[model samples]
Structures are given as structure tokens and as C-alpha cells.
Target: MIEEIRIDNLGVITRAHVELGPGLTVLTGETGAGKTMVLTALSLLLGGKADPATVRRGAASAAVEGRVLLPGDAPAVARAAEAGAELDDDGSLLLVRTVGAGSDGVAGRSRAYVGGRSVPQAVLADLAEALVTVHGQADQARLRSPAHQREALDAFVGEAHRDTLARYRAAWAERARVVEELDDLVARTQERAREAELLRLGLAEVERVDPQPGEDVALAEEADRLSHAEDLRAAASGAHEALAGEADASGDALAATEVVDRAKRLLEQAGGHDQALAALATRVAEAGYLLADVAAELSSYMEDLQADPLRLEAVQQRRAALAQLTRSYGSDVAQVLAWAEDAGRRLLDLDGGDQRLDDLRARVHELDEAVAALAADLTQGRTEAASRLAAAVSAELSGLAMAGAELQVTVEPAEPGPYGADRVEMLLVPHAGAPARPLGKGASGGELSRVMLAIEVTLATAPDSGAARPGTFVFDEVDAGVGGRAAIEVGRRLADVARSAQVLVVTHLAQVAAFADRHLVVTKSTADGVDVVTESDVRLVTDEARVRELARMLSGQDDSEAARTHAAELLELSTVGR
Candidate 1:
């Protein structure tokens, strides 16, 4: 429930602080004294659109703030916490919205804060959805819409219908997803086939070449060795001749091994003369053995080295084949292998398109049946609830001075939709033998107001409906075309609704204002010869002050004795059972 609203620089209300509590509260004023501005401020607090033109003259910006008391575990509380808003120790939330003009003077924007934390305007809207519900002339105009009519009927049905509707919506969503997937698969049938064919061709080429992971690098090394075979052989042969001796000639030049052997023999003969010469002899013998081993390996290499043109050509051809695969698929043989692995998986998916389509089609058929069953349940619940609602509303209209009026709730068949398979509408028969007609076309403004009031009162009094209703209800000019007994009934029914929750009404009729537990008056203060800077003030009135306000509303003259007497009588009647 909204505890209070503080408005500044909004419309004709320069600065006003209004305290709200339980029971019916009414705001009354002269034609231009700005009673509607209070509702505008409340709307702003509830995330309504902000208009710069509504700002007070010369003020930089307009702002509306509200303090709402909520249950600690309420959905709004959880949502506010998700937005990083702090809650008061008393479980109260503070909401504020400020509207300011842009630098260009033509564009404007709004800022919202919840519990002192800055948040998006949409957050405020979401919180408002769970806080207050406002009814005004504009809302009555929305009664013409079929969507709104259906919503009203569903709300009247309570939680059972709501649960069924939820199930239907879930089923509808699943069906839509399945249909979308099936349509996409059918549309891309040719494309998938073409992709599969291309993958097949590429895989065949890769298999034909049969390239190994490191074949390219190993083959390149072998080709280079064959190209330089003769040079390598000549170098090895010369090194062998120098280390050992030429195989066919006498030792014209001493080889390295012969020199080392002679040195070892001299060192061995002088070993008895000095220990240093013995060590030198050991080194010379080791050098002679190393030289002989190297020469033998060189000779073997020279014998093995050979150049073959046919083998070199085969290596080149294999390299060219591998290069072709690399150019088509990747930068190298390894990358080409990776591409083949991934393409194989993709090919499998493309080839299984028909089986997937069949599965999706079967799933869609299943969801269709589920949605249809849930929608039927919803329609049946609504039909039963509609009968009780129509009867209750009809009884209320009769008491509101519309004699012998009949209200009918018609649930007609409609194409399956997200909501249900029914179109709910409200019809009214103004007199006993008359045929029922649609509400917008069949009822006067006064009748429509009373009808809405009857519905609200019935819903509020319903034992099972209280948990689903908003905490506060605002009715603006609901008594517009009503007067006398009918106006008194409107006030009485509004008070009845207030018995369970908070209700605020803006009215001009004394009959309606008299039933309020609290009365507030909006009076204009003007300067001489100028309405440009006029200010409107709102203040709570009681006792004699309340009497005078009602008198003025009744006769446009607070000083008239007759109007004052009638206002007093009306007040006395309003308080009979309070």
C-alpha cells in the first residue's frame, strides 16, 4: 500500500505532500483547481510517461516520490533487491521519478530511483505492476478493447484459470519453436544436399592422396640428398684417402695413422727416462685408433652413396599431390587432416536431415494436442466464473439505481491464441425485455462507471480474489455522469471496497465525497489579473471545514444556508454505520 506521495513542480501542483492511509479518501475541488494533478503525480510514481509541458512554469524539472509499505516477502521486494535497491528497516520502499527537459528544449527524459538506488524507468514500471492499479476515464475507454475485456474476465476467475492459462502459454511456446525448426529444415533441404555432395568430393580427394602427417618434410630432405649425391661421395672418398692410405698405390705420403704410430713408438722407448714421455705415448696411441675408425666409416658411406633420377621424380610427384591437398583444404598436411575430421561430422548431420524433420514434426503434433487441452480447460473455467460474475454485477447495478438491468458475460469461440481459445466480452441489457448489447455501445458514461465499480466491488469482496488484487485502487471522475441516489450508491460501493484495501477517488459530487473517511480539498490561490502564476494547494479537511467544502461542491457557494444544511444531512447519513 502507498503510504504517502510527495509531488513537486508537477502540473499545477507546485509542491504538495499528501498522506494516504486505509479506507476511502476523496479529493474535491472546483473545475480548474488541479484535482487531476494529484492523480498525474501518482501515475508518474507508477512509471507513467512524463511530459515536460506538465512541469510548473520556470521550474527546472518535475518530480514525484512515493513511500509504499510492502510485505517483506512480496514479489516487488524481491524484484527491488535484484535491482540493488535497499529496503527500509520497516519494510517500506521509496520510489521517485524525475522528468527533465533536454538541452535542446524539444526532447525530454525521465530518471527513476527505487529505495534510494538509481534504476531504469522499466524497473519502476515492473514494480508498479505489482503495487497500484489506477482506474480513470482513459481506462474506461480501454473497455472497448477485446484484450482488456478478456483480461477482466480472467481476473474474475481467480487462480485456477490463471494456472490453466500459464500451461497453455507454455505449450504454445513449445509448438512455435518446433514449427520454426521444421520450417527452417524444409526450406534448406536443397542447400543441405549440396553441402553433403561437396563434402563427399573433398573427402574422396583426401583419401586418394593418402598423405601422412610429416611426409612432406621427410620427402624434401631425401630429395636434397639425392640431388647432391656425387658431391658427397667425392668428399668422403678424399677424407678416407687422407686418414688411411690410397687402396691401389704405395704409401707415397704418410697417412695420419702412420705418423701417430711412429710417435707412439718413440715415446714408449723414452718412457723409462721420464714419466711425462709415458703419458704422451698413451695419447698418441688413442689418436691412431680414432683416425682408423673414422676412415673405415667414410669408406662405407662412399660405397653406399648413389643418385637415381626415377626415385627423385617420384618424390617430386608425391610432393605435388600433397601440395594440391594443402591448397584446397589448409596451409599444410596436418591442417588438411583436421579439416577432414570436422567435415565428416558435418556430413553426418546433413545426411540425417530427413530423420530430424520427422522427429520435429512428431514433437510439434504432440505440443498441439497439449495446448489444445489446456486451452479447453481455461475456457471451461472462464465460462463458469463468467456466470457468477455476471449475476453479481447485475445485482450491483440494480442497487446503483439502474432498475431491472441485466449484465451478461459472453465467452465466444476464437482461434487458438497465446491466451486461450475464447473471446470474452461484457454485454448489458439496460431494461427488462431488451436484448443484450456490447458495453461500450449499450451503456451511458454513468452506467459504465457504475458497471466498473460493481465489478471492482464484487472482486474485492470475493473470498478467493483478495490475494491477486493490487493494494491500492484509484478511481478518477468515476461519478462523472451520476448524481442523487446513484451517486450515493457509487460512494457506498467504493467505501465497501476500501474496507479491505486502500481506495482514492477524485469526485465533484457531494454524495460521493460524503462517504469518505478522509476529505481533501484543492483550492486555487491567484494573483490580481493573472492566472499565469496561480498555484493550487491541497489540504486535508475535517468537521466544519469538510461541511463547507461539500457545500461548495453542491451549490458552488459555501455560504448558502440551504446547501450547508443539506451537506450536513448527507454527512450524517454517510456516518450512520461507519
Candidate 2:
């Protein structure tokens, strides 16, 4: 239920506050009384497209705000919470839309807010849809939509099969998913084969190299040893020749170790004269032992220095293999190992048989059966509810001076569609003697309005209609093509709906105006400019004023005594219902 609506600087409505309450609250005024403006303002609040031209002449912006009391567990609350909005315990959601302020043109400058948080226009639209359902002359035509048909049928069935519908939907989704996967696989079967071959080739190439961690570093060291073998051999030979005895010697053939040994012996004899000299002689002897060991090792290395061509070839080959692996797989040995592991996993998936394919096919078949079953169940419920729905709508049509007008709900399977197997169409027979036809086929504008009202009245009385409907419902010129008793009945119907929901009606019918809970007369007032004012100026209308307004509607005159008396009688009757 919408608690209130406030419109500011919008079209002919400079400022107006509509205190809305549960049930039918009617708005009626003279021609161009801003009644339509009220509905337009509501449409804007519900996320309708914004136009700058709708702003009042002197105002920079137009704004509409509403308070919607929704169900505590409504899906909207979860969405609001996800958007980081706070919800009151009473389940009231505040919505506000402001358009074309200073420096803010149409486009990104326009803004909407929910629960005190600024939100995108799209979010506001979604929130509005979740809370309120607006039905205009155009909206009533939407009852023909297949989705709406299914929903209405489901609502009429009540809670008995809600869970069944849920199950059906879940099954349908799964079936759709598997079918999609099957299509993808069929499209890519050849590509998968090529991919498998490519993967196999890559794995074989990597395996042949058999790269190991730290192997690259060790191979490089060995390659260096083999590359410099000739130079190393020559250097060792020269050192050995100098340390050991050579075939020809220039001054003396004594090794340096012999000279150090001689000094050690002389120092041992002179130890008593200088202790420091004896210690120095001991260090020289240790140096002689180290020198002798290196000299012997050099001699052995020289003996073993034959450059084997085979060994060099092997070292170069191993180094080349490591280089190739590094270039293809990674910057280092570790990365190549990681690539190999990943490739192995992909290979397993590719080579595995059609187990997944078979599973998908079976699951799709299973879901199709479930969907058919649910569609059948839905069809059954609609069949049962349609007769009652028809009777209820026909009864409403009778009051609108359309007695004998027949209403029918036709449910049948549509082409296999996203909403599943059902299509529904509403039919009408406007004349008592004529055959029933689709509502669009047999009804005139006034007839359509009455038929639409009848249908709406029927749906409203359904247990779930209130829960499923948008918060506000607007009827634009529903009383346009009817008069006399018919006009009075239209007024009564509008009043009746207001008792269950917020209703705004635009009309030129005095009978309709008389039924309004709050009657506002929109009139053009010329001060500095022509300003549109509500009946607010004529507050507490005397019998004379009431007659004047009714007379204007009835006879196009502002003053008529007879019209005044009739208007007062109608008002008295409407008030008595209160």
C-alpha cells in the first residue's frame, strides 16, 4: 500500500500532497484538472522516462516522492540490502525521483534515490516495479501478454502449487543448460580433436628433454670445463715443470721445498737466541708442506691431461638440450616443470570418453518431462479458475451499465517459449445476442474501459492479487465514452477499487467526481500567469458551488440550479457509504 504521494513543480501541478490510504481513494476534477498529471507524476516515480518539458514554467526541476509499505519478506528488501540500503521494521520503502535541476540537464544529471541512498535510474525502476503496479488504458491491454497470463492463472490457484511451479522452473533451467552444453560440444567437436593432437605433441616434446631442476646450472659448469681443457692442461704443465725437476735447469735444480727445509734446520739450532725467529721458521716449514702437496697434484694432473673429443661432444649436446627446454617452457628450470604438470592435467580431460556428454543428454530428457508435468498442472488450475474469473468480471461489467457483456479467460499452450508452454487471451462479448470474441475485437473505447474495469475488479478480489500487484493503479479516462447511468456506475466502480488500492482517475463526469473521497477541481487561474489550481480554492463547497461544478460537467455551464441539487444528492449518497 502507498501511504502518500507528493508532487512538486510537475506540469500543471505546482505543488500537491495526496494522502493515500489503503483501499480505493478516487481523484476527480474538471477537464485538465491535473488529474492526469498526478498519474504522470506517479509514472515518473515508478522509473518512467523523464522529460524536462514537464517541469513547471518557473521551476528548474520536477520531483515526486512516495512511501510504499511492502511485505516484510518481500524480495525487494533483499535487493535493497544488497544495494547497501537500510529497511525500516515496518517494511516501508521511500522512493524519490528528481529531474532537471540547475546545471543538471536530462541525461546523467537526473537522479533517483531509495531509502536515503542515491541510486542509478535502473535501480529505481526495478525497485518501483517491485513495489507498485500501475495500470492505465494502455496497461490494461497488457493483460494479453503471455507471461502475465501465466502469472494471473498461478495467482488464482493460490498457494497449492507454488512449490510445484518452483520445481518446474528449476528443472526447465537445468534442461536448458544441458542443451546449451550439447550444442557447444557439437559445434567444437572438430576443434577439440585438433586441440588434443596439439597437446599430445607438446607433451611428447617436453618429455623427450626430461628437464630436471638445478640440472641447467650443473651442465653449464661442465661445458665450461670441457671448452677450456687445452688451456688448463698447458697451465698445469708449466707449473709442474717449475716445481718438479725439468730436463734442463738454468742456475740450480733444487725444488723451493728444499730451501725451506734448510732454513727450518738452521732456525732450530738458533732457537735459544730468538724465540720469534724460531716461530717464523716453524711457519715457513708449514708453508713448505702446502707447496709440496700442490706441486705433486699438479704433476699428476699434467699426466692425466688428454683432451677427449668424445667427452666434449657429450657436454655440448647436453647444454643445447637444456637451452631448448628453457626457451620453450620458461626462463628457468623450475617454470618448465610447472608447465609440464599443467599439460598433463589437460591431456586427461581431452582423452577421457563421452561420459559428460551422455550425462548431459540424460539430464535434459529428465527436465523436459518435469516441465511438461508442471505445464499440465498449471493448465489444470487455470481451467478451474477461468470460469469463476469470468463470472466475477461479468458481474463488474453489469454495474458499469454493460449488463449481458460476457468475459472469458482462454488458456492454451504457446509455442515452446522461455516462460514455458502456456498462452492466455481474454475474450469479451459486448452485446447480449452476439457471440463472444476477443476483448480487442468487440469492445469500443468506453466498452473496453468497462471490460478492463471488470477484469481488474475480478483480479483484485483474488487472494494473491494484492500481493502481486504494483502499489498504485491509475485509470486514465476510463469514463471517457460512457454517460448517464453508465457514468455513475463507472464512478461507483472506481470508488470500489479505491477501497483496496490507490487509484487515480481522470474524468469529465460529475457522477465520477461525486464519488471521490477527496474531490479536487483543476482550474486555470490568471494572476501573474495562468496557474493550475486544485479544488483547494473551493474548500468546503456549499450546495451552490457543488451544483456549479457538476453543472459545468453536465451542461458545460458553470452555474445551474438543477444540476446543483442533483450533485448534492449524489454527494450525500457517496458520503453515506463512508
Candidate 3:
């Protein structure tokens, strides 16, 4: 519930502080005394659009602030906490809206704050759900929208209907997923076939060549040795001749082994005469043995070296085959083998495309049937609920000073959407002979206000209202076209609603003001040598002062004995059971 609201520099209201409490609170004033401006301030606090024209003339800006108290576990409380808003010391949330006066004739920008923390206007709008329900001239346009009408009907239809809506939404979402996958498979059929064919050709070529991981490197080594075979043989044979004289060489090349043998024989002969000579003789013998072993290895190497043209040609051919594979697929045989492994896997998936497509198509068909069934059920439920809602709202209109007014809620077939396959429209029939017309058409503005009020009251008091009732309700000119007994009944209904929630009304009827638990009167003056509407112009009237105000409202003459007498009697009737 709203604890208080302050409006500054908005319309003719320079500054005004309105303290609200539970039960019926009424504000009565002369025309253009800033009564609607107070409601406008409430709208701003609820995240309504900010028009620069609403700002007071010559004022730099306009502001509206509200203090709302909510339960600790309320949804708005949690939302405000998420936005980093802090509760006040007394546990009330502060909401603020500021509209900057635009420069150079441009419209001003608006900013919203919750619990002293800045937030998007959307957050303020969300918070409004738990705070209050407001009805004004603006809502006449709202009643014309089909979407809004559907929402109002749905709210009255209760929780089971909402659960049905949830199920329909889920079914629709599933169908969309299936359709998307099915479309992808159908659209890419030719593309998948082409990809699989290319992969098959590449894999076939790779299998035929059968290259090993390091075959290219090993083959290159063999090719180099084969090309230089003659040079290698010559070098080995020369080393053999130096180590041990070549058996077939005609030149006089003394063998290294023979020279070593001669040195060992001479050392051994002198070894008995000198111990040092014996050690030298042993080393010379070991050197001759080592030289003989090296000569044998050199001989074996020369004999084994060979240059065969056929083997060399075979190696060159194998290398060329491996090179072809590497050119198209990789830098080498190892990389080529890796490419083949990936292509083989990808080819398997593409080969199964037809089977996957069959499965996806079957799934899509199943979901399409399911979604259509759910949409039908939703339409049927809405049709039944529509009838009940129409009767209820029509009954409410009868008591709102429109004896024969009837509200008709219609649900008709529409193209299936995320919501459902039904279009909801609320129509009004003003009198017995009148034809039913859409809510926004063929009705006076005052009648429209009453019609909406009836719908709202019905929804709020309905056993299955879909959600909790808001803690506060604001009505602007709900009694605009009502008077006498009808005005009294309007006040009584408002008072009844206020029994469970806070009710604030802006009205000019004396009977309505008489029912208020608290009364405020907005007045304008040309004091200070200028016409101004300010906080001082707003005064809470009580006791004899309230009687005087009511009298003024009754006959435009507060001092008249008859007017005061009637005003006192009205107040008495309203307070009788208190």
C-alpha cells in the first residue's frame, strides 16, 4: 500500500504531499484544481510515459515520489533486492520518477528509481503489479486492444486455465524445435550427398596408395644412397688398401698391418733386456690386431656397395606415388594419413543422412499433431470462460449506475500464435435496444470508465482472480456521470472494496466525498497576486471543516444552512456502522 505520494512541478501542482492510508480516501476539488494532476503523478510513479507538457510552466523539471510498503516475501520485494534497492528503516520501499526539462524545445528524458537505486522504467512497471490497480481515462484506450481484453479474461478464468496456457506454450516450443531440425535436414540433402561423394573419392585414392607414417622420409634416404653408390664404393676401397694392402692392387702400397707387425717383433726381442721394452712390445701387438679388424670391415663395405638401375628406378617411382598423395592432402605421408582418418569418419556420417532425415520428419509430424491438439483445447477453454466473464462483468455494470448496460466478451478463431488460436474482444451494449459494439466505440468516456471499473472489480473479487489482489486501488472519475442515489451506491461499493484494500478516489460528488474515511480538498487561489496551485492549496479536511467542504461541494455555498445540514446528514449515514 502507498504510504505517501509527493508531486512537484507537475501540471498546476507545484508541490503537494498526499498521505494515504487503508480504507477509502477521497479527494474532491473544483475543476482545474489539479485533481487529475495528482492522479497523473501516480501514473508517473507507476512508470507511465513522461510528457514535457505535464511539467509546470517555467519549472526546470518535474518529480513524483511514492513510498510503498510490501510484505518481506513479496515478489516486488525480491525484484527490488535484485536491482540493489534497499528497504527503508521502517521497511518501506521508495519509488521516484524524475523528468528532465528538455533543452532547445526537445522532449525531456525520464528516469526511475526504486528504493534509492536507479533502475529501468520496466522494473517500476513490474513493481506496480503488487502495488496498485489504477483506472483513468487512459484505460479507455486499453479496453480497445484485443490483447488486453484476452489478458483480462484470462485473469478471471483462474489458475487451471493458466496452467493450460502453460502447457500450450510448451507444446508450441517443442514443435518449433522439431520443425527447425526437419527443415535443416530437408534443405541440405543435396549438399550432404555432394560432400559424401567427394569424401569417398579421396578415401579411395588414399587406400590404394597405402602410404606409411614415415615412408616418404625413408624412401628419400634410400634414393640418395642409390644415386651415389659408385662414389661410396670408391671411398671404402681406398680406406681398405691403406689399412691392409689390396690383394688385386698392382701399385706398391705397403699395408699398415705389416708395418705394425715388424715394430712388435723388434720390441719383443729387446723386452728381456728392459722392462719398458716389454710394455712397448705388448702395445705394438695390440695395435696390429686393431688395424687388421678395421681392414676387414673396409673390405666388406666395398664388396657390399652396388648401383642397380632397376632398384633405383623402383625407389623413385614409389616416392612419386607418395608425393601425389601429399600434394592434395598434406605436407607429408604422416599428415596425409591423418587427413584420411578424419575424412573416413565424416564420410560415415554423411552416408547415414537419409536415415537421419527420415527420423526427423517423423518427429516433426508427431509434434505438429500435438501442438494442434493443444491449441484446440485452449480455444475451447477460452470460449467457456468468456461466457462466464461476460455475465459477471455485465452484472457489475448494472450496479454502477448503468441499469441495462451489458458487457460481452467474445472469443473467436485467430491464426495460431505463441499465445493460442483465439482472439478475445470485449464489447459493450449501452442499453436494451443498443447494438453491441467494441469497448472503445459507441460509449461516452464516462461510461467507458464505469465499464472498465466493473470489469476490474469483477476480476479482483472473482474466486479465481489468477493472482493476488493488489494492496491499493485508484479510481479517477469513476462517478463522473453518476449522482444522487447512484453516486451514493458508487461510494458504498468503493467503501466495500476499501474494506480489504486501500482505495483512493478523485471525485466531485458530495455523496462520494461523504463516504471517505479521510477527505482532502484541492483548491486554487490568486493569492500572492498570482494564480498558483501549490502544496498550500491542498488541505486535509476533518470535523466541522470537512462539513463545510462537503457543503461547498453540495451547493457551492458552505455557509448555507440547508447545504450544511444535508452534508452533515450524509456524513452521519456513512459513519453509522463505524
Candidate 4:
């Protein structure tokens, strides 16, 4: 049950808050009084498309929020729970949607919260659909849809054929899976051949080079030394000559070593004369020993300075090959190796082509057989269900004052589809002698509305529909083209339907309005260059007020004594029923 709905800046309804209760709630007013705005608000909140023109003149955005109370064990509650939304102890849910203004608009945002935890818009819609079904003239037209017709018929049959339906769906799904696989395999066969060849070529190229990770760095280092070998040897020889002081080279005092050694000897001779001079002699002797070690090391380095051309050539060639392989395959040897392994796997799969082809053929054959079996089962189920559904709907039509009307659920064979092979249509014969035709083609607006009502009443009690707690059913102008006893019957039947489900009727008929559990009066007022629509709950209408409102509905704006009397009598009679 929907607890309440609050609308803001939506159409002519600037700000209206409606508190809804159980049973039939009727909204009544003059035709142009903007009663449709209430239904528009509910529609937008239920994932309906938003049109910017529907927003009020001065409002920046339009928003609709609703509080829906559900049974604790309702299917909707389970769906919400599965979506990870929290549930209150009372099982009440909140749904809110706001559409921002502008052409580049962020249109229609929906949020569902249960016990204050956020959930997806889809979850909210699932819950909303379970709790309330809006049967606008437009939605009722959807009953003519093939899918909905099939569902309605199935629902009417209850669980007698449920297993057959389940088996059919499973088989159909498996067949679809096989068909998709077969198509994919056929499409990729040529591509796979090309891929195999490319991989084989790449693998051979990489293996020929045999590039090792980090081998590039070693080769580059060796190449650098080889490239500058002559210069390195020259520098080494010059350093050796300077340090060791060879013949014909600069030999200081003879060499730096001989000069320090002579200084040490002189200091040693003068040690008795000056102790500070003795310390200087020891420092000079240490300097001479350090110079001698430097000279010996430089000579050994010069001896090892010659570069081998063969090793340098090898390093250069190896580096060039590695660089070429890197360009062809990957930036590094590790990546190249990974690519090789993947290619090998793909090659094996492609090479064993005959076996895979055989497997695919076998799978396709099996799926074909399964699909046929499921189709047969589904057809049988529909065939059996159609007879019972036709009889039930036909019975409902008689109560709606269409005694000679023939209602038939015609199930015909069709090519196998996701929904199986049963094509269901509601065929109708308006008169006893008339040929049956599709309900949409045969029924007028008034007839269509009654047919939809009959279908709803039938499905409500059907076990397969799984609607244990029926949703709020809305009827938009179902009283159109109906009057007299038929009008009263419409009101009575709608009231009867309300006992099990919340029903909202947008009506101008006083007969229908009189039967309402709650009555809302919509009035339009123009204030400050803006249209404003207001709704007041008139469920507790005084005797005089009922006379005036019903009189206005029956005889326009006039409030004559006769109209008032008639209105009073209708209200009194409705009260007596209560």
C-alpha cells in the first residue's frame, strides 16, 4: 500500500501532499481542474520519462516522493533485500525522484531507501511495481501486447502447467547459448588461422635471437670500453711513465720518491739539533713510500690496457640483434617470452581444429533437440491454460454487463523464441453472431477498460501471478462512455475490487464518486501569473457539501435544488452501504 505521496513543482500542482489509505480513493473535479497532475507525479516517480515542459513556470526542478508500505513477506521486499537495501520493522519503503531543469537536463534521478540505506533505482521500481500498478488508459492498452497476453493467460491457469513452463525456459536458454557459440566459432575460424601463422612467425623470430634479460646492459658496457681502447691505452702509459719516472721521462731530483728520501736522511742527521725537524723527517719518509706504491700500480694498469677486437665485434653484433628483436616483439626479453607462451597455446588450440569442430556440431545438435522438446512442452501448457482463461474472463465480462461477449485466450504455435513457442492473444466477439477478433481491434474505449478490469480481477486471484497482496490499481476515466445502471455497476464493481486492493478512480460520475472510501476534490486557481492546482481530501463530506460537489459534477456549476436533492440521495445511499 502507498502510504502517501508528495509532489513539488510538478505541472500545475505547485505543492500537493496526498495521504492515501486503503480501499477505493476517487479524485473528482471539473475536466480542466488539473486532476491528471496527480497521476503524472506518480508516473514520473515510477521511472516514467520526464518532459521539461511539465515543470511549473517559476520552478527550477520538479520532484515527487512517495512512502510505500509493503507486507513483510512481499516479493518486492525480498527483491529490495537482495539489492542490499535495509528494511524497516514495518516494511515501509521510501522512493524519491528529482528532475533538474534545462534542455541539457539531468532528468529523473530515483533513489530507494529502506530503513535509511540507499538502493538502486531498479530496486525501487521493482518494489513500486509490486506495491502499485497504475492503469492509465495508456497502460491498459499494454494488455494488448503479445508478451503481456501470454503472461495473463499463464497466470489464469495457476500452477497446473508451471513445471512445463520452467522446463521450456531452461531448454530455450540452452539452445540460445549453443546457437551463439556456433556463430562465434564460424566467424573466428579464418581469424584464428591468421593468428596462428603470425604467432608461429613471431615465436621463430624471438627464438632465433635468444635475447636474455639484462644482456643489453652488459654488451653496451663492454662496447663502450672497446670503442675507446686506443685512447685508454695511451692515457694509461702516460700515467705509468710520470709515476715511475722511467729513463728519458721527467725524473725529479731524480724522481719524487728520491727527493722525499733525501729530505728524510737530512732530517735524520739534524734530529739531535731539533726534535721538530725529526717529526718532519718521518712525514717525508711516509710520502716517499706512498709514491712508490702509486708508480707500481700505474705500470700494472698500462700492461692490461690492450683491447681485443674479436670480443668487441661480438658484443656489438649481439647488441644489434637484441635491439632488433625488441622492436619486433616487445621492449624487453621478459615480455617477449610471455608473448611466445601465449602464442603457443593459441596455436595448439587452432591446430586441433577438427576435434573442436566435432564438439561444436555435437553441442548444436543436442541443443536443437532440447529446443524442440521444450517448445512442445510450452505449447501443450499454453493450449491447456487458454481454455480455462477464456472461460474465466468471459465470466467476468458478463458481470460487467457484456452478457453476450465472448472472451477467448487464443494460443497459436510460433517459431521458438526466448519466451517459448506460444503466441497468446485475447480474442473477443462483441455480439453473439460476430466473428472473434483481437481484443484491441474489437473493443471500444469503454469496452477495453472493462476488459482490462476483468483481466485484472482474474489475475489477482490467479496463483501463478504471485500477487498475494494485490497492488494499488488505478482507473483513469473508466466511466467514459458509460452511464445509467452500467455506470452504477462500474462504481459497485470498482468498490468491490477495492476491498482487496487500493483502487484510485479519476471520475466525473457522482455514482462512482459516491462509492469511494476517500474522495479528493481538485480545483484550479490562477494566482500571480501562475496556475496552481490543489487537492483537498473530502472523505468526511458533510451532507450539504456532498450535495454541492455532486451537484457541480452532475449539472456543471449550477446548484439547483433538484440536483442537490439527487446528490443527497446518492450520498445517503452510499453511506448506508458503508
State the number of backbone clashes in model 2: 13
lDDT of each: 0.86, 0.72, 0.86, 0.75
Candidate 3, 156-182: lDDT as tens digits:
877777888888888888888878887
Candidate 1's displacement at residue 373, Å, is 1.0
lDDT at position 564, candidate 4: 80
> Which whole-number lDDT from 0 to 100 does residue 573 have in model 1?
85
Write model 4 residue lDDT over 495-544, tens digit each, in one string: 87888889888998997788888887777787787668744421334457
Give lDDT tens digits, candidate 1, residues 465-542: 522777889999988789999998888888888898899999999999999988988876664533321223678899
TM-score to true structure, per model = 0.88, 0.81, 0.73, 0.79
Off by over 4 Å in 4: 14-17, 59-65, 74-124, 157-182, 224-228, 241-320, 330-377, 462-469, 525-531, 535-544, 547-578
Which has the higher lDDT value, candidate number 1 or candidate number 2?
1
List the candidate numbers ranked by lDDT, top first.
Answer: 1, 3, 4, 2
lDDT score for residue 157 of model 4: 58
In Å, residue 86's CA in model 1 sits off its true spot by 2.5
> What's the number of clashes in each of the models?
0, 13, 0, 1
Q: Model 2: runs farther than 4 Å from truth?
A: 68-94, 101-108, 144-147, 161-163, 234-306, 319-336, 463-472, 527-548, 573-578
Pairs clashing within candidate 1: none
lDDT of model 3 at position 480? 72
lDDT of 4 at 474: 79
Per-residue lDDT tens digits of candidate 2, residues 236-286? 877766665443456554666666677788887887699998898889889
Candidate 4 backbone collisions, by pair? 251-254
